[model samples]
Each structure stands twice: as C-alpha cells, then as structure tokens.
Target chain A: MGFAIDKIRADFPILLRQVHNKPLIYFDNAATSQKPQQVIDALVHYYTYQNANIHRGVHALSQEATDAYERARDLVKTFFNARLREEIIFTAGTTHSINLVAHGFRSWLQPKDEIIVGQAEHHSNIVPWQMACALTGAVLKVLPIDENGQLQLETLKSLLGPQTKLVVVNHVSNALGTINPIETIIEMAHGHGVQVLVDGAQASSHISVDVQALDVDYYITSAHKMCGPTGVGMLYGKKELLEALPPYQGGGEMIKEVYFEGTTYAGLPHKFEAGTPNIAGGIGFGAAIEYLNTIGLEEIAAYEHELLMHATQGLKQIEGLKIYGDITHKTAVVSFNIGQLHPYDVGTLLDRMGIAVRTGQHCTQPVMDFYGIPGTVRASFAFYNTKEEIDIMIKGVQRAVNMLQ
Target chain B: MIIEAQQEIIEEFALFDDWMDKYEHLIGLGKTLPLIDPQFKTDQYIIKGCQSKVWLRAEQQDGRVYFWADSDAIITKGIVSVLIRAFSGLSAQDIVNAPTDFIKEIGLNDHLSPTRANGLVSMIKQMKLYATAFAAQNNA
Candidate 1:
C-alpha cells in the first residue's frame, strides 16, 4: 500500500503556518521534526489532567501519572526493540544521553585504553568521549570518511586492538546525511570485544531501530527529531552493560538508599534518571511513537527515499550547485553549496521566500573541515514533506542564486 | 553625519518593496565594504558569539577611529558593512555614543534571524569596545 502523504501532512498543524506571507515549507527536519497534533494533544492532556509527580506519591493522580509515564517507557522500549524495559533511560536529549554513558564509562576505562569515534559524528558524540578519555587517561582515535563520505571501515578495523575499549559513531550524519553501515561496524567491533555506541539521533526518526537485532552495546536518540516534544530523549543499553556501569547522576530518583555514608543507587533506568523528569515530554514521545507506528517506519523510509531522490534531481539541475554526501545511502537531507555563494546568504534569501532551510556547520565542524568549507545550505525532509515542497525549494534556491551571484 | 548615514540607510531600505531587494542591497553594500587586512583576521581581532567568523580591525588616526571588518558569511559581511559605515571615520567618543536604534529603524533587526541578530549585537559591541580602547589610549 502507498503511504498517505496528505493525511500525514494534515496531522502536523505547523504545516499550515505561513512564513513571510508564503506557505511554510519546513526542510529543517534534521534539526527538529514538527510535532503531530496527536503528540501535541498528548502533552496538553498530560498538563490538563494527568499533571502530577510520579513514583513517589500515593495519591490517585500520582498513580495515574506514574502509569502513564511507565507506559511511555514501555512504548520506547518496544519502539527500539530493547531486551528489557529497565534498559531504556529517559534523558534530556541526545547530548545528555551520550554524556550519561560517557560519564558512566569514565571509571570503567583505564589508562592507555583507546576509544574510536567517527569524523562525521556530531559534536555531542565526539566531545563527551574526548572528556571521558581525558578523565580516564584513555586515548582517543578517529575513523575517517572517504571522499564519498562513507566511513573508512578498513581504517577502523586497523584502529581496533586489545587497547580499544569502545567505538562511537552516528547511525546517520546530520551534516552530510550519510547513513552509516552501523550494523557491520557493530558486528566488527564485537569481534574485537569492543563496546559500540550508536548515536541514533538522526536515524531513529527515519529508520527502524532494533537494538536486539543490532546487538549494539548502547543506542541513543532524541525524541524531538522524531516528532516528539523537545528536551526529552532515550538511551537503550544492554541490560548487563547498564547494570555494570556506575550511575550517571546522584539524585532522588536515581537512589536506592541515602545516608551520611555512601548511598546505594537505584537499579537500571532510574540509576541514570536523576531528578523530576519531563513527564509531559515522555508521554508526548510515546504519542509520537504511536503516530509513527500507525504510518509505519518502513513506509516512511520508502516515501522519504523517493522524496530524497526527487530533491537530489531537482537540486542538481541548478548550475554551480554541489551536493555533499553519498546519495546511495542517505536520508532525506541535501546539503549543498552554489558556485562561490555563502550558505548563509542562500539560507537568508530562502527565508525571505518563506523556505526554512538550515545553514551552518550543523554542529559537525570536523565534517565541515573535511569538506574544506564553512558550511552548506541543508534542506532536510520528513515523511510529511512533499515533492511539491522540494520543487518550491529548488525554485527558491535558483532565485537566491540569481540574486546573490 | 553618523546619524545622517543611518538615516540614509533607512531611506535606502525603504526604497525596496520586499526583503529580497533589501538583501540584494545589503549584499551590494557588503561587496563594497572596506575589508580588513588578512593579518587582522586572527583570533585576537575576531568577535565571538557570531555564527559566522567576523574579524574587525580598528585604527585611530588624528583623534578619529576607522573600522574595517570582514565575515565568512555574505549576510554577516553585509551586516558588518552597515555597522562600519555608521561608525567609521568618527571620533572615538562619537562612535562609542552612537545610537544602535537605527538598525531597528531600518527594519534590519526584523529581517534578521535570531542568530544573525545576536551577531549584529556582537559586531556593534566589538566596535564600541574598539572605540573605548582608542579613547583610553588618547587619554593616556
């Protein structure tokens, strides 16, 4: 069956918004996806009726809230096909999730131990490991990408050794939209007895993530990128690995017993969830997952792949436009530059035309350094986005190019 | 004259009916800006908090401050151009005391994205800091 594009578009209210007296064609989905009305309603319902603290209170409202919150965790666990419900840890966002893992590994790591990270990783994935290495006296190494923007797998294999403790890489590149071969990478890392963390911040929204099938040590993603509320995300780790790692934060929910002496930490998920959580966000994330499931991730992926092909063709028609990243394995993201024109100029001009595209280093300065450019004008798409929108974007880019050049 | 320069910018922007035309004008202005020397592109002269790398160089000659600036991004360079035109070749005290409300009056602030607006503020702050430094040197 074909994907219902129009029906899905209607689900997001922001699609109806107009920018600069023109219809809003949001192509900045890589930064954050527009929340569907279902997710929005979930948030409102929580604040309106189910607004109460969870896990601690014995009242009816608290029980109701706790039930709803726990249900959201179950939804997330199922969405990622995690082994155990306790393995899913609610976090502030992708950065927070990665930092939590990195923090836990600080004590586990030893001097001269090595960590491998991809050059295409977002700063969030790279910086935390650098800090972890600095603190633990571990060495940090990088897996470089080829000219086609694919990770140098042979180089990665060469880097892995007895000293290699962990391999960190993103499932998709936010800057270049390169869909990494993480399954292969994970399998290879496991052979070397090295733990692998996949930053699924960009992938979880567009692709199905089965942590069990992938057998990755840790998988992390932000809810905002998946049409959920901001300020919330999830981290899925192997049950044993999570249990072995030290607690990331010391606080009320993350504790089992407290005294002047050293306190016992809470088990599994709660050991990392420190304070009052984003109750509404968690519920909204569950609603987002429900929404995605209704449409289906596989179908969304197919439709978006079609959209990406259309955009690539449309954008290629423009003279002097050069696109970064390999098209064969990519999401619905097109990062490009025209002639000698700066991306900010193109992005600013496009904004005037009511097309919202991202223009910057995209939090991946190393990728930018690799490309030897300041940044590119990025037009990323969600499933709700249309070929018609891509047409408008192409026309807008053409107009901007003419004006700037 | 600085106020008059700002007034001229406002009048120029008013001639354009749409943002596209206004941005074209800004880009044109950017192309004609007195660019800073490559030596001054060092981190010491760069303004932090700008999404684009902005380099500003100031020279005080005969009790007046002359400013030259550049940015990697065209729009940011345009913004730097507007700032330089308003404050350059003015006395240190005059440049420091110049009103920034002219930027809003020209509708530039409304046209700018939040990050660009922050960059505008950073550029203005750096210019004033340069003016202040030059003023202190004169006093010494």
Candidate 2:
C-alpha cells in the first residue's frame, strides 16, 4: 500500500489554512483528529438528505435514517473485526462507553472483587471505576508504570489474582502515548478469569483494532477520535459478556414491550441504544469509516511511524529538552519539556507561532504526578502531517527554548 | 487613577507589533514584579483555575488596598504584575469600580483568553473580592 502524503493532506480542508500569519501545524491528533472533507460531506449529506429518528417509524425518511444508522453500526462492527453485528453498541464517546460497562459491572462486582486500572489512565477512565467501586464494595487497584511510561508487566502479573474481576487499560496512553501491553494484560487477566476493557480512544484513528484477535472482552472508542463525529462512539463486548451485562440506559427503542405491570427489554444493540440518538452522527461515522478504508489503516500506520521517527529525531536535537514516554513503544506523540521551563510556557510560545500542541497534564494527572512535574507539552501527529512540518516544529521548539532560556 | 494606570499599561503594550515582541516585554516585566510577601506565598492564597501556581493576596492600608501576586509561570507572573499596576493602591470603592477594558486593549489572550491557562480574570476578581470584603468591614 502506497502512503500518498500530498493526496492525504488534500483530503483535509483545515490543512490548507494559516494560523497567526503562519501555516497551521496541528500536533493535537490525540486530542482530536482533523476532519477530512469526506467526513464533513457525510455529516452534511446526513443532515441534508436523511433527517429522522432511527429504529422506529415506517415512513420513507425514517427507513432511510434507520438504514444509515444501522449501516454505521455495520461499519463499526467490521472496522473492529467483531464476530457479530449486535456486539457493537453505540454510546456518546469512550467515556460514556466505559461508564456503561462499569455501571453494568456494579451488579456483578462483589464486595471483595478487585478491579485493576492502569496508572497512566486518564481521570475519565479512572473516575467511572471509582464510582462503581464506591457503589459496590469492590476494591480498585493500580497497575504501575516505569520511567519510560511503560506499564510494569511484572506488576500487572502480581496484581492479577482470582479476586481480580476486570482489568482496565488504554490501547494507547493519551498523556505519554505509550502503546500499552494490552495483549499480555488481557491474556494474564483471562488466566485468572478476569475480563479486560481496552480504551481505544487514542488508538482507533492511527491504527486498526481487531477485537476478536485481541480476544478483548470489552473495547470502547469514540468516533470523533477517528474522523467520525463527536458524541458518537462504539462499545464491543463478547457475545456472552454483553448478553450477561444489562442495558445501560432505559428509554424508547430499547424495549421489546412495555406495560404497567411489567416491561421487557429489546435484545443486543438496541438494548443499549435508547432515546433519539445522534442519527446524523451515526451516518457521519459510517462515512468516516468508509473514508478511512480507502486510504488503508496499514498505510496510515506506516506513514505515521515515519513522521514519529522524524519528529523524535528532530526534537532530540534541542539541548536541555527532556522527553517523557517510551520512544520505541509509543505512537506518534512527543511529550517533552525544555530545561526547567514549565510546559505551559513552552506551549504558549508554540501556540503564538501557529504550532498547535497540547499542554498541561493532557487530562492524565496521575502520569504527571508519577513523573513529578506539573505537565509536559505534547505534540501528536497523524498521517496527513509531513516531514517539512516536523522540521518547522523542531525549529519552532529551538526558538521557543532560546526565548525562554 | 486606576483608569490612568490601565492606560499607562496599555500604552506600554501598544509599542509591540507582534505577539513575540509583546511576550518578550511581558517576560521582562515578569522579572520586575515586586515579590509577594514571603508569608502570603503559601497555597492558601493560590488561585484555583490556572495551570501554573498563582498566589494572590491583598491588604488594605488606611483607605487604599495594595495587591500582591506571584506565579511560577513567567507570563502569568507578568500578567498579575500588569493587573496589580492597574488596580493596586486604590480605595476599596475605586478598586471595585475600575473598568477592565484595558485587558482587551493590551491583548494578553495567551493568559486572558478563554483557555484560562493563567487566571488573570480570576486574579482581578480576587482583588475586587478583597476590596469588597474590606469595604464591607471598614466601610471605605
């Protein structure tokens, strides 16, 4: 598969724009990827043509909308390479997806049941399990990481026991960009009869995930993290696991039948999907999946790796710049600080130069706390990014360091 | 008098054409900000929203209030200094009534914009809050 750089860049309209009198260098892909024209057109196409509530009415528009929504589900199902179409459930985003599963586990988790969360997991991932633990009498455990932000697999092995009910970890660390050892974690957890939930929010766009291949019990990711619309995401669970877990929300379409005396719930996908739903967003998500399919994820991954290498090499040239995270195992994310200068100061200078990067803890305060720093400036790249842009950012970082020093 | 102070700060910032020059000037001003009393530099006086640690405290002498602020981030330190120059040494009523149009006039969006990266708005609000409390207590 040939990775067409210029052709890919042309697909995104925002890439053509300028910021602060300089060309826009968006290094915030982990926060959110830039939308391609195809994705935008999908959103526009949905709102323009098929605008109706899904899963119900017999009207022509309703059928069209329902088809588009289900088609998105089909795309999500295939994109993740799940066995059954019903295994994929739509929710608001990765956060929402996790909360739903965590809520379901409240009933399943016993007083002594232990849950292990990766130390590098963001507050969003941590807080939900905390709520579940608080409500149930279950205990929450931490999986420690080393200086390079790599999870201490030995610690995970030690943490795994019969009492461990579920192990939650991200496919990629949003803060350090470490591609966590989820496969090993899953296999280890399964050995002790523990299920695994992988947060694929940061990994979904840059790479493709095969849920079946990973043998992951539960996988959650947001559409917006990929080129899909925000407020739309998918949750994949094994047939038996999802069947055992109850529906997250109760409302229209999720019900098989409702009565004053008793109510029966709908099966599989619809059981979790209730209320009006983001019909337009679902359609747009399918469009995004289709768009990604054309470019090919393998090509995107290979091209992105080159960008990562170029960025890492260039960033290492800056004197006094200390980079955090595992260079060999991470995705295309560079989290670093210049000398003793605060990351916020570094980020502000970069922003002024039209190089948009994320500063602060990147919503994973534990990672920062572990490193004993306020925060690190993060520069995340995507396939659309180029070597020239990385060179500019390297010079930009050098200039920023000079000014701050 | 507060308005005059704001205009002076605004005039000083107007000399810079681009953000780089403006940021350089802010960095210089940051180095010159008077130290917050060492005693008040604890976490109690620190503002909550900023990414960097910002400690702000105020005291009233006779009828006028003097503000003291500090931040680990230099741009933020400069921002608080600029704000202090505008609102310090004013009576409680004068400090409370001071118009803050000069914030936009000077354009410290790096700190002042909705990013709330550094809380200049919170610092100003905190200063007024001190003035309001002092006014209620001493009836200035």
Candidate 3:
C-alpha cells in the first residue's frame, strides 16, 4: 500500500498537540517513537478487560490472559522470523535483554577469554559486557570505527582470536545512525567459531529483521523505539543456547519443581523470565507490530530515506556545520553541530521553537571521545514526520546558529 | 538579601517582547562576565554537568567573597553571569543566606533552574560551597 503520510500523522495523538505555543515537530524517534492510537487502545483494553495472572490460574480470566500473552510471543517470533516459539523471551527492554545474556555467560567464560564489541555501541551494550568481563576475568576488546563512523571490519578480523568467545555489536549506532553491516559481521564472527549477539534496538523500528536469515546467534530489541509500549521487549535466542544458559532470575513461574535441597529450572523462555512480566505492554507490542505491518516496512523505509536526504542537503548548506556518521548507509538521523556553539545551546533553542531533539553524548561517550567533541544535536525522523517538518528544523538550526554566533 | 541585583535582571528581561531578544541579551551578558583566570580553568575548579562544563573560582577579598566563572556553552555562561552578579561581592554569611528565588523570577526557570541537571544548578551549589569554606576560614 502507498504511504498516506497525512492520515498516518493523524494516528498519533501527540502530533496534534503544541509545545511552547508552536505546533509540535517530533524528531526524537530514535529515543522513542510516539505511540499510535491502536497501541494506546491496546493497553487500555488489556487493563480494562484481560487483567489476570498467566500460566497458573484456571479461571476464564486467567485462561484469556494467558492466551493473549502467548499470542503476543507468537507474534514476536514471527515478526523477527525466529524458528521456535520458546526462543522468544520477554524482558524489560534492550538493556535488560543484554544483561540477561551477559549474566548467563558468567560461568561459560573463563579467565583470559574475550568479548569483542563495536566502538560505536551505546553505554548499555558496552557496560554490561564490561561487568561480565570483570566478573569472569575475561578481556573486553573494542573493534574500532573509522573517522566516518564505519566500523573497520579488518580490525574485526584481527579481534576475533582463539580466545574470543562472542562478538557483540549493534545493528545500528544510536548516536550517529550508522547502520553497521551486521549480516557481514555475523558471517565473519561465525567463521572464527564465535557466537554473535546483535543489538537490534535501533534497527527493529526502521527495518524488518530476520534472525534466521541473518543466522544470528542472538538478537534483541526494545518495543518503545517502534511505537510500542515501554518496559517490555523480546529477545530471540536459539533454543539450544537458551536451554544451555542458566536462568537470569529465579521466581515462581521459572521453576520446574522446588525442594529445600535442590530445585529444577523450567525450560527455554520461562527459564530466563522469572516472576510476572509486563502483560499489557507485551500485548501492546503485538498490536504495534500489527500496526507496522499495515504501514509496510518497505514504504516506511523509502519515505524516511527521502526525508533524511532532504534534511542532509539542507543542513549541509549551513557554514561550519559538521554532521557525524556515514549518512549514506545509516538510518534517518542527523547529528550535527554548528561552529563554536555547544549542542545544548542549539537544542534548547530548537525546543523553544516547538521542536523536540536530543542533545549531549547520547550515552555513547566512546564515539564522542573519538570525535573529540562534547556532543552533537541529534534529530531523528520517523514515518510520521513530514518534509515540512524537516524544512522547519533546517530553518530552526540556521536561526539557532545566528543567535549563538 | 540580594534582591536589588535580581530585580534589575527581571526588569531588563521584561523589556524584551519575545524569548529571542531575551536570549540575545543573555548572550551579551555572557560576553560581559568577568573571565576566570586561565590557571583555574583546569579540572580543579571544574564543576562537570551532564550537558556542559563550568569552571568556578572564589576568593575572599577583605571581608567580602568574590566569584569568577566560565562555561563552554555561551547560554550557560550567561545564566552563570547573572547568578554571579547576584551573589558576588557579598559577605560570606550574606552569600550563604542569599535565596536563589531570583533565578526563577528572571524567567530562566525552565532551562537554567536550580533543579535542572544543566550544570547551572551545580554552579549555584559550588558558589555557596566557596562561601561556606570562607566562612569556616574566618571562624578558624
């Protein structure tokens, strides 16, 4: 179906609102996309009608809730093209998902073993592996990126040594919007007899992911970034790998049988998910995937690319403006800074004009350290954003530069 | 205690019809702020905020305390300049006793409020810290 931008914009209620007496121009989709009416209604309906504990109770309410939650898991598995239903594990979000895998590897890794991560990863990805390495006495390695923000794949070749157990990298760089070649990264890492865990938090919203096609050992994404509710996301791990790893948490549902001396753990997903999960958020996440299906990812990607080009061309016109990342292969995010002006100043001015953008290091301090700058003003676009909005932002940047100068 | 200096800021901001002029005036104020000595610009005097870096220095001249500061972000520098204008050249005790209500009254509550993590609030806290240190020295 063709993209109906006008009608699609109406689906988001917040798009109609105003900020600072000006119409809201939301350009912070990378942080979190504005929820659609369908997603909001899904949450409300779940709480109003299907509110009950799952997997334990036998009443009609309990059965209905259990079916809804399981149906959500099925939807997630199909969305990411995971092979088995039990392979999809629900967690708080991407960070929680990563920590689960990191914690699981504590016993699997030995001293002097290695975990290699991309230089462009957000702190969430880097810190977890660091903690895991600290615990297991394994060394953490960095696969450095080029000046243009592309990962140096040759360095990856060298980094994957006999000691390397796993390679961790993001499908997309959140700070600079560099779409790392994960398919190639996965293939290269596997050739060296190592497992690869891909952080798909940034890619799941922009592109359709197929874990089977990529042959990725593990993949994870947060729901909030893709027009779904916060506090819930899906982690897709191979069934055998998940069964091999010990449980990240222990509670009521995750246990097979309990005894004073010994307790047996449950299988696959429940093994990782302990206690009650975000039921409503899980169902809402299903609704969000359905919503994206209606729009079609191909259409969204094409339109967003057009907007990114429009923004890049307009921003490049300004003197002394430097944009980070490889824009040609990246998602629709423009992170730039004007000469002699701090990103905070520009971002604050844009907010006053009713534009929402993210400033600061954006939780990627290593990338900032690489660029030798404080931070860049990041403006990310979604399918709901329009060309008119990009023009307004371009004008906003020019005005901010004039004022700061 | 330093309401006179703060009132002047409020009156000056009231002349502007829009936030643009107010910000332009703020930039002018930042330019007018007395620069801190180059030696004090290191991390020793640095108050690192999430968004920007601030270098603040305080010294007791006779019976009164004086403050000098700078920030990489010009808008933040302007906010700090106004704060310094209100608190500097007062006795250590008076500086300690001075209320920061003038900041909100000057129409900078949203961006540079004391509660914000923009380093301006930390700057205010650092100012009071210097006052307390000097007050302790006087007692000693």
Residue A111 CA displacement from its true place in model 2, Å: 1.3
Flag the better candidate by DockQ, 1 or 3: 3
TM-score of 1: 0.97
Clashes of each: 0, 0, 0
DockQ of 2: 0.76
| Model 3 bad stretches (over 4 Å) | B112-117
Clashing pairs in 3: none
Give lDDT tens digits, candidate 2, residues A286-325. 9889988998888888888888989888898889888899
lDDT of 1 by residue, A265-348 (tens): 888789999999999999999999999999999999999999999999999999999999946689999999998888888888
> What DockQ does predicted model 1 obtain?
0.68
- Restricted to chain B, the TM-score per model reads 0.92, 0.92, 0.92
User: How large is the i-RMS for each model, in angstroms?
Assistant: 1.4, 0.9, 0.6
Candidate 1's docking class is medium
Model 2 docking tier (incorrect/acceptable/medium/high): medium
Models 1 onward score TM values of 0.97, 0.98, 0.98
